[model samples]
Target: MKIKGLKQLSRTLEKAGQSGFRTEAAKWLEQTGTDFLDLVRDEIVRAGSIDTGSLLRSFKRGAEGNIWEIEKGGLTLEVGTELEYASFVNDGHWTGGKEEVRWIPGQWHSGRFQYDPGSSSGMVLKRQWVKGTGYWEHAFYIFERLFEKRLNERLQTWLNSL
Candidate 1:
């Protein structure tokens, strides 16, 4: 007896096992990244940090903002914002250096704080430090759990298909 179509069988198996797996994994990664982005936004909302919606919009996937790279059988996903004040909002900061109380030159209009150096009306903040909301941190913690569960399910499904 002679083996026939062994080369063809090998090629087919390679394509289905390797390339197919990579394709499926990439899809799952992209979906997870999108979900993670939404989670971060939700966390920010939960933290009551939505002021101008700029920071929220900054958390996107693509070359313009967040990092989303899937190449050469490798995957990389990062969700972040370019807004400078995002970190300040996520992490607490001192209102003023070595000052117990500081007068901020901002006016409150429509229940929103607006900074105006020339504004005569201002409010004094007596707190030395503002508490961090930790929205990003909380989002990451949630993502970790979600990612593990999703990965396991995807892998199991993929293996079953094979």
Candidate 2:
């Protein structure tokens, strides 16, 4: 989108802070980020698949200096964590079987022992291949439409003031 009075805005931003280009870009990025996050949350919530409320509640949308990031949960993935599962839900996961094993906590005077899942021999974990729903794609499509429509007006208004 063409932002009117960009040069003027840049100069003003630099005077107010540091890098004007970065500052101006951050404003637009934040606006789009908010829209993206909201639309994505709405889509996921309406789909009623995973816990959209929790996912959306932890959604992150903002810029770090010149970089803009939109993330659903933690920045990094940790095994056995909600964020890991959320990643699987968003992109789907491959079905594979590994020898299943677990440890039973000590009880009374007994010590913990390695437990094999399924019968005496070993059991293969069931595989469930889930197809990706392209949840993010749907949200991006909605966000694009919204930003395309509103960006010009917002930029024009901001420019006028500048």
Kindly provide the TM-score of model 1 when superposed on the true structure, using C-alpha atoms.
0.69
In model 2, residue pairs whose N, Cα or C atoms come closer than 3 Å (at least 3 residues apart or on different chains), thus clashing, are none
Q: Worst 10-residue stretch by lDDT in candidate 1?
A: 63-72
Please give, for residues 1-162, the per-residue lDDT of candidate 1 as tens digits: 768988877776776787577778778888888888889889998999888787777676753445455453676655576677788899988775675787778789999999999888898877567888999999999999888888999887876576
Instruction: Give the range where candidate 2 is weakest over 10 consecutive residues by summed lDDT.
Output: 72-81
Model 1 lDDT, residue 144, Cα:
93
For model 1, the superposed segments whose C-alpha errors exceed 4 Å read 1-16, 62-72, 99-127
Per-residue lDDT for 1-162 in model 2, tens only? 898989887787665554343455556666566666667667667666464455555554431111234332333221111344556666777666454443333322255344544435432346567776566677778867787678778656655555
TM-score of each: 0.69, 0.51
Clashes (backbone N, CA, C under 3 Å), per candidate, total 0, 0
